[model samples]
Target chain A: MTNCAKPSANCAKRLVNSMSVSNDAKPGVNSYSLRDIDAVLSAFEEGRLTPAQAFSLFREMGPQFEAPPGQGQDAESSNASRLREALNELDSLIGLHSVKRLVREILAFVQIQKKRARQQLATEHLVLHMIFKGNPGTGKTTVARIMGKIFRETGVLERGHLIEVERADLVGEYIGHTAQKTREQIRKALGGILFIDEAYSLARGGEKDFGKEAIDTLVKSMEDYRDRFILILAGYSEEMNYFIQTNPGIRSRFPIHIDFPDYLPDELIQIAELMLKKREYKLDPWARNHLYTILTKHASNLDHNAGNARFVRNIIERAIRRQAVRLVDKENPTREELMLIRREDIGEGL
Target chain B: MRRCIVLGKPNAGKTLFVLHFAEFLHAKEVTIKFQEPVAAPRKGTGVDPEARTGSAACSLDPVSGSDPGAHGRNPGAGFGPSTSEHFKTYKIQDAVRDLTGPRPHTTRCLQSVVLELPAGKGKKTVELIDTSGLTDGIHQDAEIRRAMSQTLSSVRAAHIILHIIDASKAGKKGAVEAMGDVDYQVAAFAQMRGGYCILANKIDLPGARDGVKKIRDEFPGHIVIPISALYKEGFKEVKAFVLREL
Candidate 1:
């Protein structure tokens, strides 16, 4: 019967109801988080908690108390910021403009589906299984990793970590071994994403091979654990197209097909520079010019389907080694001298 | 299962409205489940002395919503425990006559009945509960006080709160059914919950029109359905609201 439980009547007589305007239009059942409020009021009535004690228990029942703790320091705002933070990482990647747009669309679609579910409206089935078609290093794995983070932030997935495997991991050497290996990979990928790199190779041996068993296993697991994990098939675009065409069942299953287009030479240069900056190194003017020449000629000189990022990583890493060898004999290299990579660092021609 | 609770001050037609609402949902008989107030154990947070410091005004944050584990708790920590539960099946008309009365605080314990609502393709079951009245100040009778506390606890856990206010007695400045601090507290506490709505009852009585308008004007932005609990006038809107929320 203390004043804390019963406030002055006149104080909030004209208070405007902000419930309708708050919580990002979700203004639904999430607003009044349960049981804790009941527990407190009853405790107060039972005299276990003082009026003052009950009042503050009610106060500590803040907005994000419902959000699972330990993941976010400040749950309410940080969950939202994490989504943006994940998206910003997506945007910072060089090229893949269409991938970025499509990612945003997928995010919007996922968010709308959740809202529709909240409202009891008919939400479209969340079939997020996707086919990522691109040559190696067209940011396929990078985008997949980012997608997992974005999905986690949106509450779509639990762990959001990536388990990457290729054909050898799924299609084993002998008979029943393929299914066991595939199942093990699927088990490891249950909460997050199962990224199958060079996915088309599983379909390479045709109907008579053990690869067919692996495909059947993957498709069965996708159905067996729908909504539990997201399956991403990534490889050379043409081979992926042929793979989907032959296995007619796979096409309908993965509704989203994102084609990772090859980065233009200029775009490749930008990617290389970004990579250099991340490695705490800078390209001298001569070295930048040398990189531009090598990448521009890379189309005719190198294997067409080799991962673009992989090739750049190869060149950058090799250059770092060559630069180390060149500066080894120096009396004492300045910070700038150590940081810079000269044209001589580049392996000539190849 | 969404729990839609009917609550208000004593003699505000809460019991009648609940029975009428049950009938409105096409129930011929209602098996009412009676539950007494039981203390739920507080977990996840340690007891702190600072709980006495903050303002008591309603902050609609869901408390301990993260405890999916608490879904399965020690027996009585959920609802009814220790006390023997009484399940009485009464025809809709018998319930109206037997449960409701003109005297204040007639309905003491928590009484709830499950009614099915037509939602899209399949039907959904919503529990409609009627409870004892909440008063402005502490009452001398410990039984009534405990019942009021039970009603408050039910209101906290309910998915939808249908606060039944008597329109006929609303206009007078100082009447038994006059809006008081308890009403304001309930309104503010339920403000953040989307399933909260007001039902202005006794619309069949004279002077009830003014009461409905006054109720609407006083609590702006709230959906107030004017209904004669005896006549079941605004039962359609109530059903639609329930359907949408459930």
Candidate 2:
């Protein structure tokens, strides 16, 4: 037999109103029948009604359910853990000492601004459009990607994904078309960072080219979106400087310019070791020395586009493949032999 | 409108093919409808398809009279109630010259143009949609990913799928491979559906002949047409395919 009360007008409202007054069940619910209570309870249990709906129904039947506290605290802690993980990932990256420091500063600034907003204080505008000047294969793209994730974790962006486009993605062939092309990319990058690689190429096509139109569209979008999205233009140092010099408006729009220097030979070696460590591979003493000697040679012969982490990656990957091939013919190879990259495995060229 | 979607990786000449194909059909004015991802009032991920802003009407002057066989076949095509009358016409030369570029990912959002091809005593109206490029692996940009997903959904709804591959760049290192994993997946998925064709674009460039062989090798059972989209080289076959499918 169910314990529901008899039906009456305003019975649901009265039961809900009496929830804060008493913890006793059926104190105000005298109208509903036992069968009605059973049906409603089963509906709630079957997921037909939401918690709030079920609670309201229970209250109307003169039963009170108190939700325990600490749920907010649990959510906050989980968010903090995610943020910690993202920052730790950023810290684990090799080199880019200055880049890490800049990211810390930005995070602190954003945090302070958020705190100020809660106190009803006027906060400083955070315009994070930046210029990243470096050689090819540097950590511009990598760091930008990390920063996007960090920003998303910290609530600075709705979605912290990185959209990487080159000049070809931005510039259209004819007049009025460049704006459409650039705007489309911008629209896609609304809640994230628009990392334009080789951005200087937008200015390379000379006068009457649609590159200028693309630039104009980009600037307009930057102004329009403001803090909603971060735009990071990356390119080689000299060409990027020339690009900004020709387009004076760009320098003012991008207040943060970070110059990524080439990694030293030792730093490159550290990066190489880190890469190898990630793959659970080891280098023999002879192979390590050979790798160092090759690095030294490449460092000496560095061109404008040299000093690349990507080059190191290629070398390591090739060495791993070579090592596999080397051990393939060996009968009953030991575990140590399988894990090691020998001197011959390290290729001659970078 | 019966939708024919042009899809591929970036720099695959999808946009060029769309405009040149429009020219092939002798469309005077092309109204391009841009389907942007705008948030809905009730649901967060709800995409209201009929936002209908920023649509451009391009006038198509210098209509091609070159195809004697395809010309004057149908007189009253694409004027039915099914055809949308709101599009702007563009000149054929102006549209071709402006629409085609040496860029990747030029068309980001879904841009649909209603074009009519002459058929037996009438015309068939088809909505030719140009979409953003889809790259293999995960894209870092949330916007690009969203657009790509949207493009995929659009692909499922489209009647005809024209998959464009840059024939010139197919075999080149760091270029769009002749048959990338994503390409293979899309091709295989489209196999279950109707009217899917691969357009081996940019045959005017060097190494495209090899690209053709590579494409044929990768997509063994599919129809692959080799053409220079810039010169309208293999548009006749494409038109025939569209006609047969539509």
**Alpha carbon lDDT of residue B222, candidate 2?**
95
Span of ten consecutive residues with least summed lDDT in model 2 chain B? B76-85
Give TM-scores of the second chain, every candidate: 0.82, 0.77
lDDT (tens digit, per residue) of candidate 2 on B92-190? 676656555566555555667888775321245788988777765445544454455446545645678899988887777676434455576567666
Q: Which candidate number maximizes DockQ?
A: 1
Per-candidate Cα lDDT values, in order, are 0.73, 0.69
Residue B39, model 2, lDDT: 20
Per model, the share of native interface contacts recovered reads: 0.08, 0.00
Q: Tens digits of per-residue lDDT for model 1 on A1-350?
A: 44335344222111111212232244443334222464445344433333223323333453222211122335538878999999999999988999999999999998887677656688787789999998877889999999999988876786788999999899888899999999999999987899999998998875678999999999999998886789999988889999999999999999999999888778888888898899899999989998888877776665683338778878888999999999999989999999999999986734
DockQ, Cα level, model 2: 0.01
Error of 2 at B96 (Å): 52
Q: How far off is residue B79 in model 1, in Å?
A: 17
